[model samples]
Target: MNPMAAMKAYAAVQGGGMPTGGAAPAAAPGFGEMLQNVMGDMTKQTRAAETQMTGAIQGQSNMIDVVTSVSSAEASLETVIAVRDQVIQAYQEIMRMPI
Candidate 1:
């Protein structure tokens, strides 16, 4: 998947919608909502990959399709992990801030 398209999809799933010329009126999604969205996306990608692999095993899908799906799922998983790490680091930094 194209990185820009992936980013746009992520933003949309986070309740921000795709960026427009004007600023979006919606408030940013809460941490829980963001986490849920990310998890949901990961689940979808994983399922798709699994389905594609199963089809390939049954000789109903192309090997290239299976490979693409698996790669997309892997990328999605990595993106989630990276985002999770960033969120944790931000929380730790915030906790260390003098109030």
Candidate 2:
């Protein structure tokens, strides 16, 4: 399966659920846990890109692969940051509204 699909599946499993032939309901991760997971994935992708860059520099891998990996990691990191920012902004807006 694609990585995102796999991640969702794993997240569902982690939340004490088994698939019942349909998509699971959203289960928001705690703030700390979400941050931790994002950081972990960022670190992993950064390391992988670094490894690819190192290989390319040493003539052990192709420059195209290194560049692609780096860009993909950068994009993924940006997406995570954007999502976190949006979530924070939403909370702030909710706090400001009269309830």
Query: What TM-score goes with each of the models?
Result: 0.71, 0.64
lDDT of 2 by residue, 11-87 (tens): 75587656567888566566577657766777777888999999988999998989988986887688677878998
Model 2 scores a TM of: 0.64
Tell me, by TM-score, which candidate is best: 1
Scored against the true structure, residue 57 in model 2 reaches a CA lDDT of: 82
- lDDT string, candidate 1, 1-99, tens digits: 437546855675676556667876677767587578767878888999999999999999999999998998899898888888998999999999999
Clashes in predicted model 2:
0
Question: Where in model 1 is the C-alpha error above 4 Å?
Answer: 1-28
C-alpha lDDT of candidate 1 relative to the true structure:
0.81
